[model samples]
Target: MTAELILKLAGGVPAAFAACLGFGIVFNLRGKTLVFASIGGALGWLVYLLASGFAGDLQRYLLATVAITIYAEIMARVQKTPVTAYLVVSLLPLVPGGGIYYTMRYFVSGDTGMFIETGLHTLAIAGALAAGILPVSSLVRLYGQFKKHRLAVN
Candidate 1:
């Protein structure tokens, strides 16, 4: 809400967007699909920043992943594309790149204590991200099934 926060978000969002855009390109997404994928990443980062104040890192990543996954699902349906196309790019912003790096760094540096701690932290964050996506995707699948059953009945 403050100007400082707004500026920070402005700076971060474009980085998130670019990260998604870059990954989308790597994954062979093009045109409008790539744009939407970038938007998803930016939106997820915004959500993470907003929720970070209220929760720890794991919780923040979980919240952001859930939001982006839902957005990706909706976009996929509207665009008649696979959800993975969008979800994969969107998740770029939320991935624990730093955690993974630090975990490896600690291990290579021969710091067993830090390595174990960082490794566990990275795993927990990764799990949280997965936990966020599973429920929403399942619900979407369930809704599709119910719809199919209803239409079949008709």
Candidate 2:
């Protein structure tokens, strides 16, 4: 059991690392090789694992939000770029496009219950993502301010 657990945890790192590398490449393609791309990828995988373990859309959404916010702040600082770039890419994994599509299809096929549930889940994910990011961004900004002040004082 311990070995299995260790294997799972070990498996996650390479997946996360590759994801981060891919994100980094894409972000770099845009002339911004901010470290946040890698950070966002790692955070996204971590959130996905944790959220999946919880077996709920809300948890996934919240995790995605947190990941996005952290990446956004880091990108802003490292690349001296706008937060939107980081925000957009970081959110790519959690957008629930598949959910939305299935929900619409179900509705067209006259499955109201599935449609409603899926729709709700989709909305919850969206809400959670938004909720998770706001506070984190504020905190990052605060930290940045503190660092700036300390540097100036020195």
Candidate 3:
């Protein structure tokens, strides 16, 4: 809402987009699929940025990952591709790159206290992201089962 917030979000957009697109390429996504996956990543980062103001670090990752997973699953269904394609790419943006870096940095600097703290925090964020993905994935599988059953009946 504020100009500063908008500017920050704007700055993040390209990083998110690039991270997703690069991952998409690495994952061999082509054409519209790559674009859609990239959009998912950017949108996820934007949500993370907006929500960070209100949520703690773990919560931010959880919320962002949930949104990206949902987007990836829907896009997968529509695009006739495996959810992994989009999910992997979309999640690249939300990966705790900084956390990992700082954790390792502290460890190498012999700051065992800071290293332990940062390492635990990074692990927690990773856990939160994984937790976010599990439910949506299960829901998608359940939906697929129900749809298959209905189709078989009719």
Candidate 4:
């Protein structure tokens, strides 16, 4: 890989590590919990890259959502806390804040064409992420239900 790519990867790693660590500490994670969260974040980034490689921007976002959601669910199970806490950090990278900002800037400047384009792009990204996560969330719920059913039968 080129130096730029290496730098980008490195930048992502530390940001993810710090985000995960912060989330873990805030949520009272102990022992190996911090390590796990950091690992999850790193792995999530890798998943994002892999998914992005095989698809377009929207599909990439969707794949990232699926990866992050799975990571959050697994972390919740391990940490014995709600998934929201970890998810908050896990989704830091995927947010469309920059897109929204640019869109608004273009709108304020009366650049209707650019504004519309940016807005549409932002919505498409959001839609892809939502679409990707919905299935994972549904699967998790279904798995939980199956576990419950098994327990009830026994």
Instruction: Using TM-score, give the best candidate's number.
Output: 1
Clashing pairs in 1: none
Q: Per model, state how many residue pairs clash.
A: 0, 0, 0, 0
lDDT of 2: 0.71
lDDT tens readout by residue for model 4, 1-154: 5676577678877777777778778767666656666676666676666664467877777777788888879888977877766566566567687999999999999999999999999988878777867888899999999999999999
Cα-lDDT of candidate 4:
0.76
The order of the candidates by TM-score, greatest first, is 1, 3, 4, 2
C-alpha TM-scores of all predictions: 0.94, 0.67, 0.90, 0.80
Q: Which ten residues in a row have the lowest lDDT in candidate 3?
A: 87-96
C-alpha lDDT (0 to 100) for residue 20 of candidate 4: 72
Clashing pairs for model 3 are none
Greater TM-score among 2 and 3 belongs to 3
**Taking the tens digit of each residue's C-alpha lDDT, what string does model 2 give over 64-153?**
578668767867787887877677666666667788898899999999999999999887777777888889988878988999999999
Q: Sort the predicted structures by lDDT, highest score first.
A: 1, 3, 4, 2
In the order shown, the candidates' Cα RMSDs to the true structure are: 1.3, 4.5, 1.8, 3.0
| Cα displacement (Å) at residue 115, model 3 | 0.8
Tell me the spans in candidate 1 whose CA falls farther than 4 Å from its real position. 2-4
- Best-fitting candidate, scored by lDDT: 1
Q: What do the candidate models score in CA lDDT, each in turn?
A: 0.92, 0.71, 0.91, 0.76
Q: List the lowest-lDDT window of 10 residues for candidate 4.
A: 45-54
